[model samples]
Structure formats: structure tokens, C-alpha cells
Target chain A: MSGTSMTTRAWLLLLPLLAVMVAVIGWPLADTVGLSFTDAKLVGTAGNFVGIDNYVKTISGSNFQRSLITTAEFAIISVFAEMVLGVLAALLLNQQFYGRTVLRGLMILPWALPTVVNATLWRLIYNPEYGALNAALTQIGLLDAYRSWLGEPGTALASLIVADCWKNFPLVALIALAALQAVPRDITAASLVDGAGPFSRFRFVILPYLAGPLMVALVLRTIEAFKVFDIIWVMTRGGPANSTRTLSILVYQEAFSFQRAGSGASLALIVTLLVAVLAAAYAALVRKTAGSNA
Target chain B: MSALEIENIRKTYGAIETLKGIDISLDSGEFLVLLGSSGCGKSTLLNIIAGLAEASGGDVRIGGRSVLGVHPKDRDIAMVFQSYALYPNLSVRRNIGFGLEMRGVPTAEREKAVLETAKLLQIENLLDRKPGQLSGGQRQRVAIGRALVRKPQVFLFDEPLSNLDAKLRMEMRTELKRLHQMLGTTIVYVTHDQIEAMTLATRIAVMRNGRIEQLGTPEEVYDHPATLYVAGFVGSPPMNVLDGVATGEGLRLDGSDRLIALPVHFKNAVPSGKRVKIGIRPEALRLVEDDDRQPALKVAVEVVELTGPELVVTGRVGGQRVTACLPPRTKLAVGTTQAFAFDDDALHLFDAETELAFGR
Candidate 1:
């Protein structure tokens, strides 16, 4: 075939996907960008041109600032904890032992559950009165009495982070376990003969193989944690003076709860920009690690 | 004292025994090779000697001390694996010095030793590269540098050259022999290649079914194989065995009624009508004229292959296939009968029942 005809045929084959993308994603994104420049209200007139008024208000607001910090804290702490716990679990499961296959199968239960179901389950366990956590802590004499786990401003976000890690860490473990299996047996044996103790072997020999895959896991979990919503919404509804309100929750309040469509669009776009920046930084880091490892 | 001694070592995996009872002792500066086909426990025995695998029973000693329960690092041994297990993340310099670093050697000292080892292997230029960036031959050199930098009491090689191409394998084989001569360290090497076994070993231990079939110097094992198995395994174009019955005057082959004269020494050794299997190497048989007086077999030629300087001819001799290596210029037609002569000393007789050589 001639080059021109081949190019025309390629474009023809891609036409259907392009149509669907414009209809589904491209149109809405353009509409949101237009709305962000106006003072539009939900279910009302297309208001007058504000010319960056929504963006100025959303950026300068204390709500956006506080929520950004909360999101950062949640993402950094939860992703770090998940990575450490996941790798430890993967290393333990990689050993030769009885019922290891069964344990590995069971490890995925929390991650497999629906997000809403997992959130509800954790809420019951952390119930302010007569919950399993309170009963166990009191029985062990570690708690003087039952305390509100999800109802206090200081403990609510910490409790939510614990719940998030429990539900998501298994995904990291599964990925790390697969990479661990790819490590050659000969290299480990070589390390043993090289006078490496268990700690040294893990650090120098095994960690190099795990670094690339775990970096991928870190990027994925961090993005997901920064955008966290459904679990906290179901468990706490951003209550206890909005201490656990993340960026997504604030966007929800602005757009749906307060009926401020224009500012909500602007805030949502800001969150998207922040996430894109984070993802790009992580991508550059992942490339550096992969290059060195190779 | 022997530099390494393996005392009646045995290993079992559940109900399957991989190494039944292996005992080998090597003096300092000797190169011992464990040679066998795959699944024959040659690698298992090397692992036991290196302390990479535990023996289910018996003991291993290095430098006159029992190291049965000792860790691999404490056993004063180093091994080069077939996979060239250099750490993929480390540069060639760190890969060679990793053992020393793990032992808490000073960085300057480790760097000096690694440089010396790299210089000896002619891989000094590759120290900054990772194993992934290296060619197979360079990776092999790095693997050897890792083992050599340790200066342990014994070195174990588990088919380290088998992963290379044929030309590279031959080159590395020569390099290994030269290294052994220079270093004079006790070594235990494992390989199934007969040519490598013949060229590199001071002594070769032929193994089968988790037991040593034959262990001796290369010449001794080649010239006088203790069992029928060793005889067939030790040579290329392997030794041919023919079934025949001993008569009062001569020996009668099973498929032919004619009797061929037995060597004079074997005439009294075998009683009349005794069954025996005769083994003859391909090189031992030569093309002879019809009126020659030496004991000979009349073979009908089937195929002739010219391998550069020699011709490998395969033919039928009384219902048995026999191969002979003859000079390249020899002219012989397919389907024509020819007489192949043999010397008296080249005859190897094995009992049909026991399969053991008549005179050990």
C-alpha cells in the first residue's frame, strides 16, 4: 500500500475511539473549564463571566489550604506505612512453610472487598460504644473505658489512615511478592556464600530487585490516597469538625452540598493539577531507579 | 593433609535419595571434576562440598577440619555457578568485592584486592559495568573474579562454562586450566562434557544414580574403565559392546555362526560356551586388509561421516551396530563388507550378568 493510503486507513480505524472519547471525556472537561471562569450556580442560569474569580477564591480560601495539607499528610503517611508493611508481609510469605499458599490467598480478602463494605466494617469495629476495638482494649486493660475512635478531631484522621492501610496494603504485597519470585535462586545462594547475613543479604541482594516494583506501587497508592473519599465519607462523613476532610471531600461539599458549581469546578481542576505534578515527579523517580537497576 | 575431604555424604528429598553415599578426598593444588549427565547427582555433590546444601547424612571437611554444620560463608569455599550469579545491581568491582565487604574488610583493602583479581582475569576495563551490560564471556570472567578474590581453601565450579557458546566454552576451559595451574588451589568442578572432563581434570569422578561409578586420573579412567557404564560414558562415539559366546577354540558371535579367535590371555580366562560382552573403542578399530592376521570383525558399512581429519564409519557386525574412527583418506563403499582389526590389549571383557570388567 502507498504511505498516504495507509495513513488514511489508520485514521479511519481510530475514528470510533476518538468519537467516544470526545463525547465522554473531552466534552465534559471543556464544559468544566468554561464553568470555572463563570459564577454559574447549579440548576440555574449560566451566570456572568467572572474571569478567574472562582479560581482566585478557591486558591485563597483557608478551606482549600487546610484540605491540601490533610491530603498530603494522609498520602505520605499511609503510603509509607503500606509499603513497609507490604514488603514485610511479602518477604514472610515468600519463605518455605506450611499452609503458605492458604495464607497468601487469605491476605487479599481486605483488598478484594468493596470500598464501601470495608469502610462499614471498620466503622463497626471502631464504634464509639460497645465496639470490638474498645472491648478488646478494655479487656486487655490498655484502655480505661470505651472512647470515641471516629468522633474525635485528633484521632479521627489517624483512625481513618489505619483503616485505609488495612484495606489497601494487600495490593502492594501482591505486587512485591510477584517481583520477589522473579529473583533468581542462584543469586541468593551466592549471597549466602559471600558472608552476607540475613540483613545484609536483604539490603544488598534482594532490595535491588524489589525497588523498581515497589516504586510503582508507591506511585499508585499515593495517587489513590491523595484522592481518597468513599471510605472516609462512609465512615465519618468528614465529621468531627471536618478534621478528616480531604480535597475530594471539600470538592464534594462545594459542588453538591453548597450548590456552588463554578468554584467547585475550579477547585477540582486545582486538585487534578496537583495530582498530575505528583505523578510526574514519581514517574521521573521510577525511571531513574529502573535505569540504575538495569 | 588433604585440602578437602567429603566423608560418606548422603542426601535425601523426602523418599527420593539424590546422593546416596559420596566420599572424595582431594589434596591441595589438585583439580577434581565430578562428571555425569543431568539428574545424575553431580551438581548435588558439588553443592554439598561447597556447603550450599546440607548432607542428610555424613560429613564434609575443609583444610583438616569438620565443616558439617558450618555455614557456607564459614566453610572457606567459593563457587562459580552455571548462571554466572553476579549481582545484577552491582558494578563488576563491587560484585567481586562483595564477599570481602560482607566480611567487614576495609574499603581500600577490598578495592585493592578486587582490582588485582580483575587484572588477573583481564577484566580491569569492565569493573564499572554491571553484569547485564557484559557479554557472556565477560560475565564469566566476573564470576571467576568473585570466586578468586576470596582466596578460599577450595573453589567449587558448578558447570560455570556450560552456558557459553561452544567456542567460548573451549576458551574458558583453557583459561580455567591455566588459572588452576597458577593458583594451585584445591578445586571441585562439575560438568557433563567429556571433552572438558578430559582436558581440565587432574582426576575425574564419573557419577551415576547418586553414586560414583569411577574415579581416577583422566588416562586411567579412559584406558581402564571399571564398569560397563563408565566405559560407554567416558568416550565420544562411545565404546561398542557385542554379545558373544566363548567356544573351546574361539568365540562365536550371537548372530553369526563363524568363530573369531579370542586374545591369548582371554582364552583361559573364559571357560567353554561362557557368555561375555566385549567392549571396543571406535579409535581402537582400524581398517585392515582381508589377509591380515590380527583378530578382526567383518562389518558391512552403512554410513561414513568425514569429520575433517578423520572418518567416522558406522556399520553392522553380526546383528550389532559398530562404529570405527579411521583416517580421512581411507576409501570404503557403503553396503560393502570390510574387515576392521583390533589389538589384543584393546579388548575389554565384561561379565554378561554382572556387567563388571573381568580384570579390575
Candidate 2:
């Protein structure tokens, strides 16, 4: 009797959380899986079971393949670039300077802003007619003429990557800076007295502390960059013959624009699977590095 | 020439002076310990000597060559920090060989040197393990090994054994002293532990308020403290001090009561009405069998503590709380009044106004 009452009390305490979790996460996930199996159109009669037809159609399409490649290219290049820039910025900001505290507070403003706002801001900055980038380039004599940045297929993806890096790299810097601070002062001092030069001291003493956090930041940035939608939508909208069409944009266009909800849902599921595989690989790498270091 | 010489070293932060100008020099194989309480700037002096910290004004010379603007890595000095500061990512062998590697020593030669240093430290088997795997004492040994492999002109230890447990600390203390004997290297160490200073140093510089109060051998400092503060600070269950007024024949303990009397033995006449403090080490005051000399302090015992080997008594000695270490099994009831005789030769007299030692 007592055990039953105790379990009842435990269930009472956990009920609200369980109800919220199922409502927010469980239902949509189950619904998405169910929809992936059917030929459900955005606007039509009730659809029949398509079995694996939607999955096959989504996979065999060249557009989906190209989008996957683009997503991978964008994520790998941008996350790598961001990691380097972020670590450098973190190192600079960690130093004792006149306005260090204020500068640190201001460093995260880009990341703090809404993603759409950041994308819109960058879109204006990349505008061929009156963008600051083109004006600066022309004034500096780096460019003979103002070239269309996001409007041209050759430069669109790279420009989107740069814009995306600028807005999100602060997350890495913030994490890296916190890790850098935890590197013991005495260890750095010890390295100095051990005849290490500044670069060597940073490599041997400070880099170890940075590796774990950098990996964690990389994981977060990779996942975010994989499903990137808002920035490309605002800046280029996968335009200039879809040169910057990522997997996320491809899935959205298939479902909402083309009204093929079954294939779109299947494509989205495929994207999720790809991201899950990549995330698992990253997690495995982190664990392996941690184990080996220990 | 002296191996390490600090000429007028000083450090300040805005309005606060952390280290007053300090001058010290050590012979080629001397183990010089900078002994002090916290905030005395011993560690600051060591840091300046190592070139880790810039002095406001000073010239530090190693092997008679001035290292005023030299980098710490080029200073021909290695330091062991209190935290052990072992590179967490590296194996013990790598940690030890890092300095040699930095100097561009050949790989085989560096490995051999690391091995030899590890063997010397009796940590040869633990070479492949990282710092995280080692015990506190082992990590400390590895830290010392790192410094030893550098083959520097001098070694600086900034309270290196402070992070270890008491038993391990004592063991490491002995190990350090033995290593010093074997190496005969010039070392400048900083520690607040007087026992470490006493047992390891060829000479101890007792610091107070960013200045060396006295510089002497361990025996000289303990047997003959130079100032009131030094006398009080140097000992465990520190020296008991009794303030009194100097009279024609001796010093009177109380203003009117005259609970205890201390005779001024120095030929330099102390003015009759001057205030003086009579300092006597707790061990120097004897519990008498037959009272030939009048006892200096007659007091009620407050706290009685059994500190492993000996019984420690905390009691009032003329309105001032003082500590005494008595022989084991010497019954000291909590509220009983007992007379303790002061040794004349062991008595330390200091002028109250100046706090300078008048006589020992």
C-alpha cells in the first residue's frame, strides 16, 4: 500500500513534465515519421501509403544531392573558419587591456541579435548597388568595379558563408575565452621559465585547455550550419540558379513551394539522419580525444 | 662570484608597494630560503629573480651577469610552482623534457636527460603516465624533475610543497633536502613554513611587511631573533612576550602590581622610565622543581591540547594570551595557576617604541 502511494506521488511530481515533453517533442516527431511514409500532398485528398517511394524519390533527385553537398561544403568551411577566427579573438580579448571588460561585453552583439535580423543586415551590406563592402573595396582599389556579391552564382555561397560566420563565430569565441581563463596562470608562467617562447607557451600550455571547448563549440556550430535556412533565405533565397541552396532550403522548397509534402518530409528526415550521423561522429571524436589524453 | 645576486629589487602597484627594495646574494651552492608570513613579498622577490615578474627598480645578476631585461626563459633559471603546474596534456617524460626540447636539445639526448632526471627522482616507472595519474607527491617530484632537467644556473621554488598533505609534505621536505645535498645547486625558495626554511636553507631571510627582518642561518634566527616580530613569528607555539616598564634595577611587569621582573643586562643604559617587551621562547621557560628564580608568569591554564607527541597549553601570561609546549603527562588542569621560570640567556628584550632587539 505504501509503495503504491509513493509511486503515485512520484508520478504526480513527474506528470506535468512528461505531458509537456510528449506535447512539444514526441507528437511532432511521430507525426513526421508517419508523414514520411505516405504520399501526403500540401493540398489534396487524403493520401495513401507510399511505403518507401517518397524516400527513393527524395534520394535519387540530383537537386537533393547537390543541396546535401552544398550544406556539407558550407558547414565544413564556415565552422573551420569560425573556429580559427574565434580562437584568435578569444585570445586577444583575454588579454589585460585598457577597455578589455567593455570590449568583451560588445564582442557578442552579433550573436545576441536575432538570426533573421543578422541575415537582413548582411544582405544590405552585400547589396551590389550601395553595399559598404563594394564601396570599401572600390575605395581601397581592390576592385575595379562594384561586382554583384550575393546575386552572382560564383560568389553567392562564399558571401553567404562569410555573413553566416560573422554572425555566429562569437559563440565559439565566448566558449574558447572561458576555457582560456581556466588555463592556470602558473602553468603559463612555468612554460615561460621552461624556456618556451610565446607561441610555444600557447601551444603547449594554453592549447590543451582550448581543445575540449573548441570541439564542443565546433559541434554546436556544425549542427547550426548544417540546417542553415534564415541567412540564405534573407541574403540570396537560394538564388542565382540555386548556387547557395542548402539541404534545409531544398527541403522547405520541396514541401511548401512545390507542395510535395510526402517527399519533402522524407527529404527532411534524410537531412536529419545525415546531421545525426555527423553529430554522432563528432561526439565520438570528442570522447576518443578525451580518452587518449587521459 | 655569487651565483645569484639581487640588487635593490622593488615592486609596486599604483599606491601600494608589494615589495620594498630588497638586496640579497647567495654563494654558488647555497640554498637560500625566503621565509615569511603571507603578504611579506617573498614570492614576489623570487618571481622578480626568475624574470617572471618585472621589478619597479632593481638589477638581478646571475653568475655576475646582469639579467635586467632578459626574458624568464633566457634567465638560466627554472621555477617549481606551488600548484605543480605540470602540463596536463603531456606525459611525465614529456613534461620533464619540455625545457630541453625548447632549448633545441637533440631528441635522443633529451630523452636520455629526462630518463636520468626521472631515475634520480625515483619516478622512472611513472614516465608514461600523465600528471593526472600521479599522486600529489609524485606530481611535485615531476615538477622538480622538469626544473632539474633544465640544468639552470639557479632553481626558484615558490612554496613548492604547499599543496601537499602534512605527511607527504614532511616526506617531500626530506626528499628536497637530500636532492639539494646531491645536486649542490644554488636554490632560492620562498615559503611561509618555518620548518621548511629551517631544515632546507643554508640561510633563511625572515621577511615582514615586504622587507627582510633578519637574514641568518636557521640556528641564528631561532636561537637569536633580531626583532620583536621575528621572535614572535619564527617559532611554533611562538615566543611569549611580557610588556613592562623599565625600573632602576630591572623591568617591572605590571604598572603597579609588579607581577614579573626583567633585568636589563645590556651595558647601554636603558632609560629608567622606558617601556620594554621581554620575549622568551615558550620552550625556554622551565617548570621548576625548586624555585631558585622567581617565575616570570603565574597564570591559569585556558586550553589544553594534546598535539600527538606533546601537550600544548594556552594560558594568560600577564594579561596576554600565550602558548606553551609542556612535557607529556605534565598535569595541567584547565583552571589551575602554575609558575613557569624564564631562562635569562634565552630572554629576548626589545625596546617597545622601536621594537628592535635590545639584547638576547
Docking class of 2: high
lDDT (0-100) at residue B293 of candidate 1? 72
Given candidate 1, what's the lDDT at residue B275? 88
Q: Write the per-residue lDDT of candidate 2 for residues A106-149, one digit (tens) a residue.
A: 99999999989998898888889999999999999999999899
Question: lDDT of all the models against the reference?
Answer: 0.92, 0.88
Candidate 1 lDDT, tens digit per residue, A178-282?
A: 999988989998999999999999988999889889988999899899999999899988878989999999999998899889888999999989889879978
Superposed model 2: Cα runs more than 4 Å off: A1-8, A279-294, B255-264, B267-269, B289-296, B301-308, B329-336
What does the lDDT read for residue A234 in candidate 1?
Answer: 98
**What is the CA-based DockQ of model 2?**
0.81
The model with the greatest TM-score is 1
True lDDT of residue A140, candidate 1:
97
| Candidate 1 local lDDT, B141-211, one digit each (tens) | 99999999999999999999989999999999999999999989888999999889999999999999999
Query: At residue A123, what lDDT does model 2 achieve?
Result: 82
